[model samples]
Target: MTDKSTSAPSSDSVSHRVADTSPESDRGEQPETIHEDRLWCDGGWTARVIKNEDDDGWAVEMIKDGEPEPALVGPWTMGRNKKDPKPLDVSAFNTLVKTASEVLRRHEQQLRAQLHKRVAVDAATGDGQWEITLDIVPDDDEPYALLTAIDAFGEQLAQVQVAASFKLSKASAASWVENGFRRPG
Candidate 1:
């Protein structure tokens, strides 16, 4: 048996029960709470327009998934009368995602090039080529570099320690290879 008396719901209770109760929501579907002015782009990226804290203008921020900070943040276009921000659209969101992804990709490539530099030089043995690699280990206490040489058969020919400041340009690498991979005087 149940009580027959009806009671009014409290304001807090009503607000708590106003959650998204759609079937899609229960099924763990994609997020649907995004307003038309904000978007969750594909590839784990999100773009949002917000009021600029520094001024009375607007700004856009592009954040990647699981990141605490935005990868890209820039000014947003103003609407008519220059008070409101222009609404975000599909075209603009896609473009921002592309640009942000490119920025990340180029940053990674540049870091790789800096930490590990490589050059191919003609082997003085007159048989096969040799590969010269300089790997920089930037330790906080003692930074150093590992200069290595490998023959065509992937056998390590020589390795030595050099200053982390050593620059591995094409001309410098060629000289090293010609000089038998020894520490330059």
Candidate 2:
């Protein structure tokens, strides 16, 4: 018996597949937009209603184009028959897009907060407050952090490259400022 999963999709099922529209494609034509009962692709996002492996219920996943993972996945409502998933509609798709976009935005904000930090330290000379900031570059080959000191006039006093593991705390910033903004050992 032929394996249904490995067999070529029938002509009727071809409509559900997204066409190749990448720069390397010979046609270089944009795929026809899809708006089916269980799938949608528009606004650079796709919402798909799928079977939930954890349970008999249904689930929906929203994927942004070019991203390998789904941005959002959650329980899906049941249809009137209670056996099939509720059909995807324009309103539902738009709402899913908004929620998935928000998820991505929040992730970016959290990452930024983790990689960037700031603190204010008083100079020993009592000149003014020094704004000290730490910006981390998370490169895979060579990770590092930049420690910067900015004077009250917003002029950069010094910047030094430090280990990515450098911890920027109040005491550390103060010690660095006391040491004349030298690279921390």
Candidate 3:
């Protein structure tokens, strides 16, 4: 019952979509499923996730808002087995949210990896060791990373860039730390 402009796919350009796919990849994003749930968004396009009613096939709807629409509607596959949808609990919801967030993060990572490059380093020698993976910062040539090194007894060691891919092994890293982390020529 929502407007079409807010729920349908734009027709400005052509796109390619596959008919069959692995179960997890669908996420209720089928052409028909898009139309059923009143799945409307912002750009005069809406998608609906059809709910199972009376044992009927799943479906979706995608139409523009407020235009006596029905521009795009089709059949869709069920996302989860109604026979066992795993009861929705606070813990389950929390876990679902966490998983969803991680999925988004991985997607973002893939995008970044496509645009950036990385290198792995493992510098080690007896009595000294360092290990780190470094990143070649995009648009810049400086190599930065999280560096970890320890002297034999696991003494407090120099640490940095834990959030990045910077790595260095023992010998050189120890020397660098001992020398106050001077940029190596």
Query: lDDT by residue for model 3 over 149-176, one digit each (tens)?
Result: 4445545455444333433444445456
Leading candidate by TM-score: 2
Tens digits of per-residue lDDT, candidate 1, 18-71, equal 245678668865334343443434446778777799999888899887779988
Kindly give the number of clashing pairs for every candidate: 0, 0, 46
Answer with 1 or 3, whichever has the higher lDDT.
1
What lDDT does candidate 1 reach at residue 81?
Answer: 43
Greater TM-score among 2 and 3 belongs to 2
lDDT of 2 at 185: 96
**What's the lDDT of the predicted structure labeled candidate 2?**
0.84
Off by over 4 Å in 2: 1-31
Comparing 1 and 2 by lDDT, which wins?
2
Ranking by TM-score: 2, 1, 3
TM-score of each: 0.65, 0.83, 0.26
